[model samples]
Target: YDSCVNSVSDPSIFVIFEKHQVYPEYLIQYTTSSKPSVTPSILLALGSLFSSRQ
Candidate 1:
């Protein structure tokens, strides 16, 4: 898992997950400026991450 946090023009968080053959790679991005709520985006990404493990 590689993560990057940038706070330039638009503050945002980016995550990259490198998986094996059994799982697919996931790129999770969260922007702080555009959206009014960030929980849904985080929850959605986490849901996908956990579900893929099963």
Candidate 2:
């Protein structure tokens, strides 16, 4: 997959990590438990981690 990553056109998929996180599972459950579509707000909440200075 690493060799093909450069050929891929999708900007959303970059890399896959082996580390697991309960928070990510929680986010998926919360988003999919009720509705099929994942809310943008929930995505923003998850993405906020990268924006933090600390």
Candidate 3:
């Protein structure tokens, strides 16, 4: 996928975004029991790591 990011929502996702130097709007909140993840947890993680520092 061109311009698409592979997300994992397990803090590991940050590696991809950080490496690419851009943030994906969505994140998959993968959990120890969740199936096909999605929701606020992932979003918060993304924001925590990728959002503008200023």
User: What is the C-alpha lDDT profile of model 2 across 1-54, one tens digit per residue?
Assistant: 222233456654445444342124343333336547889998999789778957
> Which tens-of-lDDT digit does each residue in 1-54 have in candidate 3?
333435545443333334565666898785486567779999999898876676
Model 1, 1-54: lDDT tens digits are 354447647767644454442354687888668646668889999999999995
Top of the candidates by lDDT: 1
Q: Is candidate 1 or candidate 3 better by lDDT?
A: 1
Worst 10 residues of 1 by lDDT: 15-24
Clashing residue pair totals per candidate (backbone < 3 A): 0, 0, 0
> Which pairs, if any, clash in model 2?
none
TM-score of each: 0.29, 0.27, 0.25
Task: State the C-alpha lDDT per candidate.
Answer: 0.66, 0.55, 0.61
Report the alpha-carbon TM-score of model 3 versus the true structure: 0.25
TM-score top scorer: 1
Is 1 or 3 the stronger prediction by TM-score?
A: 1
